[model samples]
Target: MMKIRKLLDIRERSIRYGSVFRVLGKWPYEPLVDFLLVYSPGCDRKSNLVVSTGHKAGLIMERLPLESSLEHGANGISTKWAISNWDEWIYPDCPIEDVFVID
Candidate 1:
């Protein structure tokens, strides 16, 4: 969760569905943590679903439902799909992945 708070210090407003970010540099405790921080600024300005790192990944915080889905695969395999297809979503060297929105 702190990783995301750090990212929020560099808050990205333009984000999209299925976007991927290649973590750059050496974040503190990056090797110790097994989760990636996924951020979505939302397309309509209101998020329909919030995505965590991946199945059994990311610091879910106090959110039990979100954590359960990732840990238990209760999200109808979407979590598994994300894990299995993680590499496919990667865009070389991109830190924040998404389409820029002009408001």
Candidate 2:
């Protein structure tokens, strides 16, 4: 796992769900770290579900109940889907696969 060097700053607002912060961390390039930071702004919006970076993929795989069916947001699906698919802004040039530890 990549070690976060420091949390540069944090901001909180109702629209942002909770704490929003800039963290400094080592990546192969500075842009990669920047890319990882983009997800912070997206935390506030409501959706069918929220998947975050620190939620380990292994934990998700282990705990997700098989009988449950997730109700995806049909009306706000586009914007919600965009959140799932879009890369964060700090490293606009870095590909998503290289930035977030989870896909």
Lowest-sum lDDT 10-residue window in model 2:
8-17
Residue lDDT tens for model 2, 25-76 = 3442232222111212243433322222342211111111111212442222
Name the regions of candidate 2 deviating beyond 4 angstroms: 1-31, 34-84, 87-91
The TM-scores of all predictions, comma-separated, are 0.20, 0.20
Q: After superposition, how far is residue 36 of candidate 2 from its true place, in Å?
A: 7.1
Best model number under lDDT: 1
Residue-wise C-alpha lDDT for candidate 1, range 1-103, written one tens digit per residue = 1123222233333333333232432333232222322322333221122223334244332211222123332222133333333334421222333212111
State model 1's lDDT: 0.28
